[model samples]
Target chain A: MKILVTVAEVATVDDEFEIDGTEIADQYLNADLNEWDDYAIEEAVQLQEGGVADEVVTVTIGPEESEQTIRQALAKGADRAIRVWDESLEGVDLLDVRAKTEILKAVVAEEEPDLILSGVQTGDDSWMATGVSLAESLDFQWSAVVNDLDHDLEDGTASVRRELEGGVEELSEVDLPAVLTIQTGINEPRYASLRGIRQAQRKPLDAKTLDDIGVDAGVVDGSLELTDMYEPESESDATVWEGSAEETAGELAEMLREKGVTA
Target chain B: MTDVLAIADHRRGELRPVSYELATAGRELADETGGDLHLAVISGAVDEFGEKLAREGVDVVHTVADGEEFNHDVYVQAIEQLVDTIDPQYVLVPNSVNGLDYAPAVAGRLDLSIVTDVVDLAVDGDSLIATREMYGGKVETTTELDAGTALATIREGEWPEAEGTADASIEAFDAEIDEDAVGSTVTGFEEVAGGDVDISEADLLVSIGRGIEEEENLDLIRDLVDALDATLSSSRPIVDNGWLPANRQVGQSGKVVTPDVYIAIGISGAVQHVAGMKGSDTIVAINTDPNAPIMDIADYAIHDDLFDVVPALIEEFQ
Candidate 1:
């Protein structure tokens, strides 16, 4: 079985950062492999190592600058990589789920992999809908927020544990040619070794445009438009203990005592 | 048609709290659009759920009696047909786990604009303005969908539940579900976090998060937990890192803990984490970042490094 994992290079903002219009300031922003996609890549790589998957390929919808982050996935054991970008995709404040679905669906037509894996959501947008939207667009079976998977796919079925709210898990079986949105903690993502990093440089990393993938630029006109961005007004009226660590600790200790919390 | 159709969510045999909240949101939007509010309760005791959801301001309840549980294919098909039948301008859904499973599919199938995890909503003329968080709640953004008609998933706990029964009409709408399209089957639900200790039962809980840093530092937290005679709990990251078991995880996907005192150390109080433990009597935060989301909700806080403060805090109790 060929497993295709959807990866993204998400932006991380500094704890103390300024929002320059609808975007964060360049100095305070850093790009890295999406934390959730890191797990999805790991799961796909492990399936290949366990002999359930014949090949593990990664697809990313990012700009040219994100190749370094995409190579991180290749370094972690994905066979190759595809980076989708075009001039039409630039300057769009927010790429809604449907636009992404249309773009990924075009790639799916070419790859035609047996299974697809994507992170539950991206760290930046957190739309949490692209994977399932892509599945619907392609008419593929899908399971969301999956935390566990049984690698035995001899019967062309994927058994998964869908993590629900309040500590409940739903065990389900999805037929083959399915899309599974991987949740974190399913497996530990391995760090790229020296050998893997060298190999990644030699691996195939193809950059495709919307035209190259047979997707129309009109799809870039996503329905959603980001109008405003700002730091949420803090509603905090918290009593902050000040001074040195010792003084703050003393103040907190006194409060705990007032609450009758005994040591 | 300017009507608003909202889908209700349920698991096992009971309607989740978000269903009533959806009713409230649907009614609000319906009022804004000068349209009636239509609620759809699909699958799993729909008749009972339909009646239960027929609250004040709800104009109609349409139930599709189908499978015993939530099946995305069933929901997608049912919602598609319902939209065709009612021709509503907006479809509201709960932004819960099950909501994530089907809302996007419905949006893609119908080619409607979709927004998820929205905290607030308003209808302005022909556009829908949605307020949502970005970068894990660090910044808020308002997105406008000028498409006029779209599907949006409202976050749980954002709106109050609709109360007081109404004389709203309840009807059964037949939804043609294709068995061939239903490719997934839910075997059963297993309640996790079953272990020696239940953090929900503890009075004083000391919760740690990513701020704990290295695995070796967990020992310092363990020491503090012992010193205060408080139970040990943690945010999702700590449990995700395998430093603590799922049983000790205090967050939306874990356990809803209402302890007497919740001392959050090194935790950034993500929305999911706050959902689980915000009901605690006393909330304390110890983090170096004063602007961490946890500080906003904390009753008392100490904006200091956990390494410097935790050891000193432990010394106080000892």
Candidate 2:
């Protein structure tokens, strides 16, 4: 079995004053691998370690700098990495759902991997629909927010535990050659080691472009446009209940009751 | 005139409330777009449920009673047949497990622009503008569908359930589905434990998060829930740590809840967690940290240690 891991970079806020400031669109930039993507990579690594699969490949579509994010996945144990590098890809307002569907469709058509795994959602788009969209695009079965996975390579089926509401868990089996989106808290993602980082630097990385991937930018006209960004308004004269622990508790409880919170 | 079709979801021969909510939403959209509302029911012996749905301002209820259980291929084929016959302007489905599985296939086959987990939908001139949370719950983006026929899987609990006025006529439609197309078969069905609570139907919920500390502390929240007769739920962290079952989790990765009163105890309120419960009518957050994001949107906030506040609340309720 071969699993492909896709990663995307998102922006981080530097100052509270600029929480929603437009400057974040520019200055707050860096290619940090999404936290959930680590889960996907870790699952792939576990599959490889168990000798269940031949290899695990990491893919990312971003600027040249995104190669670092791909490298980060390699350090976490991806067998190889591929970067779809194109400067024109920056600020392309495509949600991960649409962008990943286009890219994964192209990649799946070429690789035809037994299974494709992705973080349930990316930090940037966080739509949590990419896996489903990619599955639809490729006409494959898709499972969302899988917290546990047990694959049978011989039978081409995977037993998965998915979280339901009210502390219930549901187990389902999906035939392989499917897409599974790994949810957070599925496992403790392993940290990159010096040895693994060094090994990652030596691994093969194939960089391609939109043209190479056969995704014409014209087809994906930015459906969602970002008009402007601004910081949230501040609250004035917010009451602070400060005192000893017991005193503060009493005051807080009185306030909550007054607000009809404890009724 | 164009029409809007909503697929009413049912499981184990019972109608889910979200199906009614989706029907209401579909009716509203259809009215705005000058179209008729069509409700589609797919299940065995669904005539009563189909009539129940027909009362909700729906022009027609198309019932397909073929299988004893839900088959993705069967649903896809049924939806395709309806779409082909009605040529609806928009297809609205609940963002539930069944809808998520089959809606995309219907969209793919019809080559329609698809949007999932839509929290807000509006008719914008000739297009449909669907608003969804991005970056978990940190950002909201509105996307306009250029395609004439758009398909959206609305997030559960975004719209109010419209009670049916009276019974209406039900139309039985035999969906054309080839047995050869049904590749996957449900060998069996295993019901998950604690499926009885139906957290989605609970009007009042008291949810706990990792801040509750340990599994034992859950008793305190449970006591409070008992006092209020509210359902008990948790964040993904507590469930992931095995402190609670997976069904109790409330978030993007778990169940999206929209209770009338949601009391969050010791939950720091990650964006993912908030996205699931933000639709609650009233939110009360209790956390030691005054800076917890959950407190930001909370209707009421207690900035005291939950250990102290929870026990006191439990005592008062008792």
The regions of model 2 sitting more than 4 angstroms off are A11-31, A96-99, A161-171, A222-246, A253-263, B166-168, B187-233, B241-293, B296-299, B302-318
Error of 2 at B241 (Å): 4.4
Residue range A174-217, candidate 2, lDDT tens digits: 77778888877787788899999999999999988778888886
A64 in model 2: Cα distance from truth in Å?
2.5
Q: Give the RMSD in angstroms, all C-alphas superposed, for model 1.
A: 0.8
- Model 1, A89-138: lDDT tens digits are 88888998988998889989999999999999999999999999999888
Docking tier of model 1: it is: high
Q: Count the backbone clashes (under 3 Å) in each candidate.
A: 0, 10
**Each candidate: chain B TM-score:** 0.99, 0.76
The candidate 1 chain A region of ten consecutive residues with least summed lDDT is: A90-99
Candidate 2 lDDT at A80 equals: 89
